[model samples]
Target: MTGFFTVCTMEEEGADPVIAAFYRAALEPGQWHAALRAFARLAGGDVACCFLKAEAGLAPSRAHICGLDEQAWEDGYRRYYHAIDPGYTVLKQGMPGRMYLMQDYISARAVARSEYFQDFYLRAGVRYSCSGTIRDGGGLTILSAHRAAGQGRYDGRTRLQLQRVLEHLPNVFRLRDTAQQAQVHGALAWAALDELPRAILLVDACLQLVFMNQAAQRLLCGPPLAPSLASATAAIVLRGGKVGVRATAVQQRLAQRVRQVCAG
Candidate 1:
């Protein structure tokens, strides 16, 4: 997935400042925790998480916890509650991008009696949760928000607010996937270029060398910017003294050859 699905409820240009901040956090790498926290705050929850479940029966491939102690999350959710979670089956079978309330499937009475509630939710102070799925190429992803005990179940307004975020999450994942794929493809192309026999150097618009072929290294390698190649065909864009013993005339011919090779 390259980008998250963006819910159409708010436009970036004229949206509330908080929503704008949330969008920035959601799109940035390693900023999901902040984004989730922003979501929880807006949706009336205390804790939020975004996780990937690669396959049925397997632990989540990845999870980002927002507004929860790491230990509490590990002990209460990752280590145990997930297996017995009442919402798992429902969310698993639910529509990919639709929001679903956890309380609807498991009543408070049922939660009070369940092992997950007694050992996990109660200990962590969470009494209710809501979740929505975001599609991923590798597996299923779920975004969950939790409210503490005494906070009461999520209300209709909260659900509507969460749905706005949910509707666009899938697109976010798609954008991320597309970016990653483009990066991988670019790396492969660079590797192919590196395999060419002639020395090659790639310089950016700033004239700073960003990449050099192995042949280039052998030809001119005291340091970057210190070209030491003896070939005149090669553009010896150097910043140091010449060490090669080749005749100047021969070096010029080789430099020309280098130029031709690079052009080809």
Candidate 2:
């Protein structure tokens, strides 16, 4: 399990609560906001983000950010600054396991003049930063933490603390990837079942509908009733009281199938 992450700048008063939050987040990558927020709090920074490298012209395969709105990140930074981000270029060449403070690769004076910094980071209020890269086969994971202007640079102690926390990030990411793959596989299986021509319906123990395919949705219910297989069948038999023989037979078969599925 990933351990607690602590920073030199934040008050010790809130350390216990922050550490607990980090543990929960590390175990569940779906809680990206929690993870990034915890890291930002630890580093005394305004924002933090994680990036997964991607192929040319594509945005990072995955981007998790804290303290920044989705619109600014996706529309502004991802659309423009990503094309010529000096920090990203530096991350591409960074050695695995080593953390690089912004000052090491780009001087403050140069950052002030660079288009990426001037047009994006400056407006975003990011000044001091530290980043690290972890290479996994052909993939790269980058962690970028930043402080707003006037917050001063990360000192030696902060750097050491960040390095310690970075060491466990790869393991946490591995768990997240595995879970995501499982979800994708499940979705694919359901999609294949949905493509069948028969109006299939899966109902629960209470005879309430759980799932219905596109075919089932189109066949059963009309505008007046619930547009679903079970509801349509019920309305036809109980309310209309004049369903066709073939239609009634099909409904009976569907009911039997639902019973068999629920039994198993």
Candidate 3:
């Protein structure tokens, strides 16, 4: 509410740079928190958050949050809202960028007339809310913010600011996903993938480094820095006191046995 701290408006030239910063930062290894914090700061809201659903059959996860200090923000912040909140179920009827009051939504959902209104949001000082969704080829993501009713709900200007930035939110989530996959894959490459007593060598019978567990890497310099999935099923040295055939063959056999066991 202070004049010195003006929330950036969508129509303002300053908004574009902020938008680009978040878009690029979302792709970085550990910069998501900063990007969301900046967004919440610029929005002057009590909470600004991003949610993403990993797969079609899986529930969504709370991947990012800013300006809230509560116990386990992830649950109430992600799956719980969609699973139980009537306001969100009805938000689908509204236009993408248009701002609407939470009361308008709850009223439409008959929440205003329901037994759950007071205990739900009012006692917690969360009254007004605005939300929007963006989708990529595979799935959709939601961005939302909430504020006390006395603070006023998001106006058209606020909605426009958010809508403009969130136009790129899907791409942010994509890059974030890519970064996470890279990190997990990187860890797996170094992890002792199974309880194999033999130090494995991830190599292609045709001559390529595919993947090596930590035990395997401790034996050699490490499977090549790059492991190609195509080269995973061939015979390679099973070094480091490991008495199995080349890694590729052993892994293939192990996988085949596991499949056979499952089948049986």
Candidate 4:
């Protein structure tokens, strides 16, 4: 499991918490906001975001933002300003795992003069940015940390910390993909089982019922199996949360069989 991760020793004490947040966000995409918050805190930025960069002339998608007005940012920046932003262009062309400061692509004077900066960045209160690309296969998966106009640009130490975090992003993406596939396969398997005509009951090692199909439910609700059984209504009874046979001898036999199967 650990083999999938990049080998990097993060000297900062915050590394573990940041990594944990990223992994949690990977497993559950809704947690991305929290992950971004952690990223922002670790990188010493006011805001952080993750977004996918598509082909030229196209707006980014799957944006997870923190410490900003989400709707306004998406509407103004992604929909309009992204196409004209030089920093974004540089990010699109930047190498994966390599951090790029806004200053590297466009000078502060140039940014202040550009329409993209005046109309969007100034209005958004974000002037300085440090960003990096993690995955750039079909589309670029970019992570960016933003600072307000007065706040200083991300320093060398912050850049190094972001780099360390960037090294683990691929593993997060892989884990998310694996989890999605597993969920898809699980749904399909359950659907197939539900459609089966035969009664099916899934039980644990102690014959405790884990799951039952529609056929199993129907069968369990039907008439009693034999008059000789203790219970006249049904052959199977859910007693103490375990699948139980009404007849004593049959219950013992079922338990024995289940035990053998579990052992094997």
Candidate 5:
């Protein structure tokens, strides 16, 4: 959501840089590794990972991880440990934007006895986990932060921080899907968009204008929707580098709709 970006930017004079990196990764897939590392540090986690959980199984090839071995994740965990992982099962059922602690669902003693823990988790040095479902349509996109044995379990403070971050995950997922679609179609897609009769505008997570089709440009410059002058009211206006509707009632409804779309 755009509100998430605004809050993060204003909090403690921009102490949390992870939010910016997180959004960047949504736009550019290659930045995910660095984004995960920043996220792990912010959550006080030793490792952070994000992957899509499909009906078949976890798609390890598409996973972005920090502080974990890629080979072990693909070969060892996906092949053997995924089915036996209690944490994985709980995460699969977790509500989008809600955080879940593995310790709450299963006891430490139970985890110690499990083959998944003995064979994979113990080998990987991961013991405690805090995860949440980001989006669940075609597949479940899960974001998880893990703590090593000596690091202890995630505390209340950590959980609160993680939950705040989780609120923005759905927006990031939406941006990623948009980016992928654009990449798939390339410049031809832009040309097609320009020819559409309806006015179209694309904004970033921060609500900054990124692209506006020719129709949108014409609409903005048209007489009925012309830039507002103080003496005469106009349907639309551009002020302070942002688009605005002159009518308070129309503006309120438009803003609400924008927030709903951005919240995704």
Candidate 6:
């Protein structure tokens, strides 16, 4: 389990209650605002920023920010900081175990105080920023935390705490998705089959492993399975009077059956 994350062991006079309150709020859904503000106050900076890598040419559309409004977000996109933003482009190269801090940007202070970033920060009330990558073999997820004026810039200790949050964010999401998927699967018997121990694989007509369970996840991705590593999502099984191509065979069989009935 992750440790309790705080900037320092010793707290300023009368600061504990305030920080503890934010700590409690962070646990509640839709209460990130308290935590974000707490981080800024703790860091002695002003802003808290968050980032998620997005599809190309859709920076404005997909950027995730905490303090700013749509106009600054749109302005950042229209102005092309999405491209110039070192955190976005640089952090993509980072692996989970590794992390980075922007200690020496030629335009670091300048850009932070620039007409552009400042407007976004001032309007949004953010003073500091921290970003980290969260990815499993399943896919990629990145989160950036932000702050505004007097919300101090991140220090080494703060960075480590933020990194801990980065790692946990994915698991947090998995739990959320599992809950949501459970609600959906409960309504459909076919999908509810996923709860079973059997290795059930759902493939499109194309024979891809669109979904699989722990049993299948282990088998198909293990040494025993003969799926091609090059395939996007795949598994091996017998179907249609033959072995290995269950998805493809299932599609072909269904098509043949459909054709026969149509002819009749």
Cα lDDT tens digits, model 4, 133-158, are 87656887888888887777778877
Rank the models by lDDT, top first: 4, 5, 1, 2, 3, 6
lDDT for residue 128 in candidate 4, whole number 0-100:
81
Candidate 3 whole-model C-alpha lDDT, 0 to 1: 0.51
By TM-score rank, best first, the candidates go 5, 4, 1, 2, 3, 6
Question: What TM-score does model 3 achieve against the real structure?
Answer: 0.51
Model 1 alpha-carbon drift over 4 Å, by segment = 1-23, 182-264
Cα error, residue 246 of model 5, in Å, equals 28
**Model 6: residues >4 Å from true position, as ranges?**
1-46, 49-51, 55-57, 60-64, 97-99, 104-127, 136-140, 186-264
Residue 218 error, candidate 6, Å: 24
141-203 in candidate 2: lDDT tens per residue? 777789887887888777766776676566455544544565767674345335544344444
What is the TM-score (0 to 1) of candidate 4?
Answer: 0.64
TM-score of each: 0.60, 0.59, 0.51, 0.64, 0.65, 0.47
Off by over 4 Å in 5: 1-7, 11-16, 56-61, 184-264
Candidate 3 or 5, higher lDDT? 5
Task: After the best TM-score superposition of candidate 1, give how far the Cα of residue 239 lies from its true spot, in angstroms.
Answer: 47
Question: Of the candidates numbered 2 and 4, which has the greater TM-score value?
Answer: 4
Give the poorly placed runs of model 2, Cα more than 4 Å off: 1-23, 55-57, 179-264
lDDT of 6 at 15: 38
**lDDT score, candidate 5:** 0.69
In TM-score terms, which candidate is top? Answer: 5
lDDT of 1 by residue, 174-247 (tens): 54444456575766434543554434455433323556667666656644433332333233543333212235
TM-score of 1: 0.60
User: For model 3, where is the 10-residue window of minimal lDDT?
Assistant: 1-10
Best of the candidates, lDDT: 4
Residue 211 CA displacement from its true place in model 1, Å: 28
lDDT of 1 at 148: 85
